[model samples]
Target: MSTPWHIQRMAALDFEASDKDSETARIVSCALILVGGNLPTDTRTWLVNPGIPQEPGAIAVHKLTDEHLAEHGAPAEQAVPEIAKSVAEVVAGGVPLVGHNLGGYDLNLLDRECRRHLGDSLEGIVRQPLTRVIDTMVLDRQVAPYRKRVSEEQGPYQMRTTAETYGLPWNEEQAHGAEYDALMSARAAYKMGAIAHTPYRDRPDWVRALRTNRFNSLRGVTVEELHERQIEWYRRDAEGYQAWLRDAAKSKEKHDPEAVIPTAWPLRPVPAPRNGGDR
Candidate 1:
């Protein structure tokens, strides 16, 4: 059988933002890593001066201080458009975009940044739906729905944790840096592709331990088909989680029944302007 598209080529994208709120967060740094083919990985990165105060918590994670960014980072107006153009070019070339929590976070943040600065969302710039995406987080959750947090130090689906799970090297010092995170996600994707394509009998003990047959469904699929599968997988997972939250709320547990998990894949919809007019 032919190689899976993810095993052949992918453009891994990541962004470090001003804060965790994707709707309001500004891009502080971003990276895109092109993997596969005979050539070495091509990495492009940008640091942006968001021209706003970053949350201290966000600063602690990515370590890009407002003072430092103001002095050295490119203006967001310039950086955001360049980032969008670069990603659009890669997507137009039919390469799948890979990242951890891409649909739930990075892509949504990028769309916000583009609309805030460039007056267009990334989808608007690309002029098409982002259908070629491989979200390592979504894939991992789908394949190993029962994976549990091994310790207080890490969440099971964090990029570093996922990298470790997949047998890739991890550097704590580089964990939150956009470039490093993007590269690690790409490496994890390669490993996941290997697992999916490898015969079950030949798979390692860890693969067998996953206790799920989902990887078998991934074998031999085109990138577009895999992308479509993730959309459904993510939607189902979100619905399940939302339902669990409602059940907890009904039981008088401390969960929010009103909490909603977005089912969008690759990019979430842009919120309407608060003033009831064009943003």
Candidate 2:
């Protein structure tokens, strides 16, 4: 008898690209597909030749040189099919497709790449739709909606720091690279699964509802209104509050001609001296 679908393992995909605007950026990097519930007993990765030259800036960040890729990586077309097949098999067998941020980036990129690769021969087997993508980004954002003491200018937002909010220690240096990203993604999902299995799991659902409303509401607003909302939101944040207060205290006459007045203001008091007595 065949193994039950539930007995089959679910998989997670972790992908990184050089540029969000390019095709390669849409479907690049290594993947870690696991073969179990939440955590996998086995994982695998694939290196893809994005079919375009890796941008110098992107290459600098990822260190995936085109020269090395040309020698070691599989072509995008060849690699994508294999990836799709693997993902489909797992999903069809009743396992969820998990990724760090599959809903926002990785899955869409891979889907695009797979569609591009399947070309005319796209059929029910290879080109059919897949389901149950568990997005770690959505999960993390659900846990902590509005709390960033400091925003990072670099690194995967969904991976390193976000994991920390959940009491999961994520080492960016040790956990970078596509393979590691997927592994960590799986780890994050496993952690989430534990919560989802708990009494407080309803909290994530409530947050999801709020995010859905926020996203839908954003789509209804004007671009200018959206910008204002974002600015207002940031202004309410710790970093934003500091900036808002700093600008507010500045003289209108001394305001930079190039800068616009922010719509929101902060009310934070200055911190007291560390010593008991003022210096």
Best by lDDT: 1
lDDT of each: 0.87, 0.55
Model 1 lDDT, residue 204, Cα: 75
Instruction: For candidate 2, list the clashing residue pairs, or say none.
Output: none
- Please provide, for model 2 over 1-279, each residue's C-alpha lDDT reduced to its tens digit, 9 standing for 90 to 100: 543222235576777675663224545566756656445366667887877776687777667888887788888878878877776676556566666656555654555565566742222434444434555665454444644544556333447765664467767565657877776676676665445444443545543554332323223333234334433443444344345445735535454434533322111122355687531
Q: Which ten residues in a row have the lowest lDDT in candidate 2?
A: 261-270
> Which parts of model 1 are misplaced by more than 4 Å?
249-254, 275-279
Tens-digit lDDT track of model 1 for 1-279:
766666677898999999999988999999999988656889899999999999999999999999999999999999988999999999889878999999889999998888888888788899898988899999889876778897888887888789998889888998899999998888888888888888888887888877675787677888889889999998998888787777774536657778787787777787778988764
Error of 1 at 233 (Å): 0.6
Prediction 2 TM-score vs. true: 0.61
Backbone clash tally for model 2?
Answer: 0
